[model samples]
Target chain A: MSAKPIPGTPVFTGAYAMRGYALNKMCYSLNAAANRAAFLADEDGYCAQYGLTPPQRAAIAARNVAQLIEAGGNVYYLAKFAGIFGLNVQDLGAQQTGVSVDEFKAKLKAHAIHNDAVKAGRLANV
Target chain B: MSNIIGSVATSHIPAIGNAIHKGLQKDEYWQPFFDGFPPARAWLHAAKPDVAVVVYNDHGLNFFLDKMPTFAVGAAPVYTSEDEGWGIPTVPPVRGAPELSWAIIEQAVADEFDVTTCQEMLVDHACTVPLQLMWPEGWEGIRIVPIAINTVQHPLPSAKRCLAFGQSIGRAIRAFAQTLNVVVISTGGLSHQLEGERAGFLNPEFDDLCLNALINKPELLTRYSAHEIVELAGSQGAEILNWIVGRGILGGAAREVVRNYHIPISNTAAALQVLEPA
Candidate 1:
């Protein structure tokens, strides 16, 4: 609600919701198995059917989370797009973090170990 | 009069469902996780509530981004599980307590909560995963009243509001004249972010704080803003809102009967807690 936003995170506010409506709707369509196949067969045509903006279409083509976010794509909906490419949420997270999937996974494992050590009082600050 | 018996909160990770479906409960990788659920299973069997009011959020399943409902309740007689894009082995349809569902809807609306009532709804991992973990025997004779909350997109309901919604649901259940016991189960989150540059983030410290607060100091948790939750826990950690709802259903205070927290369950920290009215 404030002019000072939450820094880096793209808050999916009313404005973002409105801007990404078409893009989100397209992503939503991937819930159905048939819809996923259809999109894979004709990506551009599917985007067009959803009335996606050029930027959104470009973002879809690029498979970039940042671009999709800028084009008003919510991460939850964007997950469907990622799934179509055999990328799970973690894969998408890796892309968003500018790291390779293996690196991202390793970080997760390290974080868990670090947290466990901290809980056991072996480590102080994590 | 119908009574609110108890509540259970657990992380409904999709991987948990897959592991269970693949019969990997005894496997080394999943053995530790499965070890935590025996107490929960025993408790469920002992309590034997006639109906369970399950609070879970759909992940692009029933309601897509086209029209995401902040709060949706299923009033259908039977609810089936969705395929969730990839082919998840289909489970038997869970029977729904439509009469109780309608009663909750009517009372919730009167309580000034805008709730979407669905005649037909599909349950996804959010609902099925937890069900699989909590009640592995399956949902053949068991009855469930599914309440879907929104934690997918931002601008989600505040922790305080979600708690209030749970309280309202408790009241509605009490108002019903059914001579049956009820259990409230809320699924999702300990701490894991699925999006942004801060992906794969986990905070056991914050999660412990949350589990403690839910048992002894739930009022303390309501102060946490969505931004603070994301900053401390992770984006998907917002699903803790569902847990808050579970706590609120028990009203003032409840004793934590069971608590389990395990980390790195597919890029997220998974937790399970059961509370009984004190």
Candidate 2:
């Protein structure tokens, strides 16, 4: 590891929002057809079947989609939020699995898994 | 009877929750909206769940941008919310269900779900602070399963894919065959951008539409192309998939329990919902 510090001055203003082609492709291609129809039908039947009025269903539909869009898709944001739950992402896979960085990286690379920060660091370490 | 229950949908702007706990809600633009949650208090108290399987996104707390997992489940016995410089005041640590956690982890893995088994985790700002203000009372006798989704960056799982993940988890939980009644919680979203000049925003129409789909028609919500959702909601708003997974785990057709929507909570729409079993 190396360190470069400038006294009383900021050195770099780097910003990174987690994004990648693999993730975008996953989002673009993943589809749930039956699930969508089932959900729509359930909302409709609520009036006759469950006793919910149209306005109520409308409100619910509006709210449900809003909720899904707001919190459902982003991965980098999710990891950041999970941190609030006390699960810190230690870059080293040593927290619980007892796998050394080097060992974990080798295993992950051999398996062709490359999205892990720990594995990436370990590759550098190796 | 294997019945369908209610669902919760809320915006999880990390900064807003922290602001409320620190008493910054009033000092900032979040004051009026933060005050909106009082009415929903009664609903939360009445439908208090014994175990809350809180589904949320990890904001680089546990996993980093270097390498991220699509979905991770916490099978730990107990968890402590980590303080990410946005101090949480006098909140008790969250309790866990070691038994259920282990069982589900084993089941999911056996079912080929590449589950991450965490023995211990410092519950950070993302999970606890919002949960604290959201549920209060710390929910006694109620255990918690902290599940993480990959939502921060691009190239993440689609909303439909997350629902599939949710269904898998629901199957695993039902397989537990225990006497304990569980409450599945999906928290996050409704809209409010997180980056660039458009960061602090609230699309009420969009937010309402989302909540409706989550409570009355989750299946419909799931089919939304990720791009469409991002178009309707902000890009950062995609974290709602965590909540969708919870709804998916609970079998999609959730009854609405409570709904509260507020905007400008420090650049967040700050919506909250508590779904019940129908």
Candidate 3:
């Protein structure tokens, strides 16, 4: 709980939990296959049923991760929403980072340099 | 008296479930991650645990913002995996050791942990993926007792508290009248963010510190607040709280039997470690 928050990594604290409760609850319903179909059948209706705020509904309609988070949507719950769109974490990462999916993927793949170095025995067991 | 055999900590990524469903254990992309398991499997098999005390955080599956429990213990006769929105095939129901589960619940509460006790809990990938990896033959042989920690919603249990809670669980296991062997498995994270502009953020250095600290100096990890953990390990990487509990359940000093760290497994820096008491 610092004045300067961890950049870009929004912690889903109690405030955010209370703020996003309705929105997250809708997403949580997506855990059941029937609920996923119900949402897809009528996205606006589902949002209304969940009593989502205008911003949360808008974020859901736009399929924007940043806007959703700004509207108090937790990433784990948002992931269920994202899954309805056939998007995985990599796709969400690409969308949020404003990069091509491949570029976002490359960024993740790039971290393997350390793995390579470690494998080469250049780094001791971590 | 019941025994604390060891602990296994691994990534419970949903992608791994899909890979398992597709028979991709040896696929080029998954080989490295899958390769990390055999040794752990060998050690775990040799340990012959009758019950596995799984410590993992539910990822919006069973518990939601409606009533999130910082720590929930499963006291059900069986724990089932349901659809997690990804359509990843659900693993078979995990047999539950209600007797052991209730014992841990009593002990954890006595130790002032105040954990939620669920008589019927639907476990998600956090429980299934790692359990599937450990018991690919199916969950018929060994029973399980799940402990779900809230790593999703913040005001998460601090590193120190989770480690302490885990030690209390260790005591519960040790005091049980059964002479059963037990293995504690904690799932998720090294470092890799899955949300926001820092979606692909990673910290191999922080992971290196943790992987070593789990074996050498877990108190070094307790010094951090949850926010500090998110800053160092990505938001999702805060799942290491699950790992700290796993380490603590080892009761004290333990020997690292095997360890593996790999990156980019669906926006995660996956790490697995199998340890036994020194």
Q: What is the C-alpha lDDT of each candidate?
A: 0.82, 0.54, 0.88
lDDT over C-alpha atoms for residue B207 of model 1: 83
Clashing residue pairs, backbone N/CA/C < 3 A, model 1:
none
List the lowest-lDDT window of 10 residues for candidate 2 chain B. B193-202
Restricting to chain A, the TM-score for each candidate equals 0.85, 0.19, 0.89
lDDT of 3 by residue, B51-150 (tens): 9999998987778777889899999999988888867888788889999999998999999999999999999998899998999887799999999998
Q: Could you give candidate 1's per-residue lDDT for residues A1-126 as a string of tens digits?
A: 743454456667778889999998888888788999999899888889999999999999999988898888887788778877777877887888898988887888775654444333343221
Span of ten consecutive residues with least summed lDDT in model 1 chain B: B82-91
Q: Can you write out model 2's per-residue Cα lDDT over B116-186, one digit (the tens) per residue?
A: 66776655555765566656655555678888886665455778888877777777677775656666767
TM-score of 2: 0.63
Q: Which candidate wins on lDDT?
A: 3
**Candidate 1 residues B1-278, lDDT tens each?**
79887888999888788788899989886776677799987887788789999999998778876688999999999999876764455577889999999999999999999999999999988888888887788767579999998887667888889889988988889889787789988999978877666667788778878887887578788898876777777778888999888777777778878777667787888888888888
Backbone clashes in candidate 2 total 90
**Model 3 spans with C-alpha error above 4 angstroms:** A1-3, A116-126
lDDT of 3 by residue, A1-126 (tens): 543577777777778878888898899899888988898898878789999988888888898899999889988888888988789999999999999999998999889988754323234353
